[model samples]
Target: MLESLTPFETVLVAGASRGVGREIARILQPNFTVKALLRSNIAVNELEVLGIQPIMGDAMIPEQLDLSGIDAVISTIGGLPGDIKRADDEGNRNLIDAARKAGVKKFVLVTSIGCGDSVVALPPRALEALGAVLEDKEKAEQHLIDSGLTYTIVRPGGLKSEPATGTGFLTEDPKISGSIHRADVADLVCKCLISDRANQKILSALDRNQMFSASEIVEFIP
Candidate 1:
């Protein structure tokens, strides 16, 4: 059973220009006052058209991130291969620090499956390919854990761009791994944003029918 939680009225989403972050921002826009942190003005128009306010700032720059009056934050920032300044660790650190400074209510971080203790869930080849990025993501996850804020760290498996399947769910099992749609990940993130059961927990998000193994699926319903 999940405890009742106060809903967050304002949300700031990092990495909302594309992928799961974009979907999360889109989902939250209708219900909450949604804001997106962008490194540049490229996606400002697009996000504004979706009823999301685009705040011009880079997550990698600490001073640029302003979380004042924001009740919650959702971060899906990542970096490219061989990039000197990866947003996976550094950018998330800045956001976490800012959230702490502003006294935000909750912080939800969307990382990959290979992060932290879930590394055993991925194949060796896949691990080799994502090792560096996963390491940075794990660091970010740890930062959030130690930040002393209400937080939920969601590590999704291989991400698909398809529409939400309505079967995406969350579990505390670190060993779970599978493919889940980006939209479904967004839905799960939104649920966790106000879920008392998800606070201070690290969860794996996946579709019920997309598991890579035949393990028992005990989902944490928010």
Candidate 2:
């Protein structure tokens, strides 16, 4: 097991502005000092209100990042509707390089399902719809896996906006396609950041039969 994180430990949560990223910072803030990297001033101010140390920088430019004393990092970095391939790949590459330069040891990447050869792991039509996204996610995942750092790549299924209970299940080799609440995804990222079970692994997860607790989900993580 990884050492339990103390309140004094520092975490650099990249993309901690909205969606799963913001939620991850929220869950971890009560436990550790969290540095929230964001692009927008409004977003930075918003997280500042929640007691997160706001660091303004774009993932595409890692040289500007200064996580010198950070203990761990979790990146929910992603691209929007179009330009998914270029943006996501570039941003992730920058994050990986920056983490290495910052000397951060543990890294957790919030990637999507169907990355790498896992693209074909999805139904054909589904793959077609998300071809560009999956390809870029594949590149990013490979970069992390090859980074020579203790890393965990979380491939969460579809995301929804809902209340989180810190519950979910791993669906590695999932035959039944489904989604998970974004809040749950954030909690999962936070748990993985602190758990050795999540070290150096690629995991796919979604809500299956029941709402599994964070520890339970990590123990059974794929």
Candidate 3:
């Protein structure tokens, strides 16, 4: 059994302006002092309205990392559509290095399901579609795994904007696939910040009843 521990006092959220990162910050605000890393003034203003403390810095640049006094870091970093590929990886690696330097205890990284060994969990067509980004995410994951920090790597499926259906489950099962609501992913990421069950684990997040089982993809993917 994983040991229970005290909640972190300060948590830095990378990519907290949008998607799962944004929601994670919102969810974490009640329990922890939430600091979100952002790039633009507009993003800063937008996040500040929601009571999230915003730090202005692009994760793609290492020099901009002014982070300090952080006990844990939750990174939901990813490339935006039409942006350059692997940008998120570069940013995440920079954050990982910063966390290591700061001696942050827990680092939760949010990557997609088609990354690394999770590729087997996706259909061949989907895998092909995700080729470049997955490779970059793979590098980031390996770095975090070898970083010697207490870490949780969450690989959530196709993100949806709908409300949480509350069917989400975390499994080490690489055979699991399918989509999860972004809110559900945020909820899980927040829980992982304090859950001992998440330490050093690579978890796939999915709706229990919506899984893309291995049997369905075996003939096409394997």
Best candidate according to TM-score = 1
Could you tell me the C-alpha RMSD of candidate 1 in Å?
A: 2.3
Question: For residue 45, what is the lDDT in candidate 1?
Answer: 93
Q: List, residue by residue over 1-222, the lDDT tens digit for candidate 3.
A: 112245588889988888899889988887678899887876787788878899888888999886679899999887754466555578889999989998898999999898878888888888777777888888899999999999999999888998888877677766778899998889877777787777988888887666766333221100
- Candidate 3 residue 75 C-alpha distance from true site, Å: 0.6
Candidate 2 local lDDT, residue 206: 76
Determine the backbone clash count of candidate 3: 0
Mind giving the per-residue lDDT tens digits that candidate 1 earns over 1-222? 112236688899999999999999988887788999999898999999999999989888898988999999999999866887799999999999999999999999999999999998999999998899999999999999999999999999999998789889899888989989999999899889878888898999999989999999888976
Candidate 3 lands at a TM-score of 0.90
The alpha-carbon lDDT assigned to residue 203 of candidate 2 equals: 75
Candidate 3's displacement at residue 49, Å, is 2.3
Off by over 4 Å in 3: 1-7, 80-82, 214-222
Report residue 42 deviation for candidate 2 (angstroms): 1.9
The predictions' CA RMSDs to the true structure, in order, are 2.3, 4.2, 4.7
lDDT of 1: 0.91
Clashing pairs in 1: none
Model 1 — which ten-residue stretch has the worst lDDT?
1-10
Which tens-of-lDDT digit does each residue in 1-222 have in candidate 2?
A: 223453228988888889988988888887788898877787867898889999878787766776788888898888754662454678888888888877787889988877764464467787888778777777888898888878988888778888874566654452434578888887677767776777887777677644222323333552
The worst-scoring run of ten residues by lDDT in candidate 3 lies at 213-222
lDDT of 3: 0.81
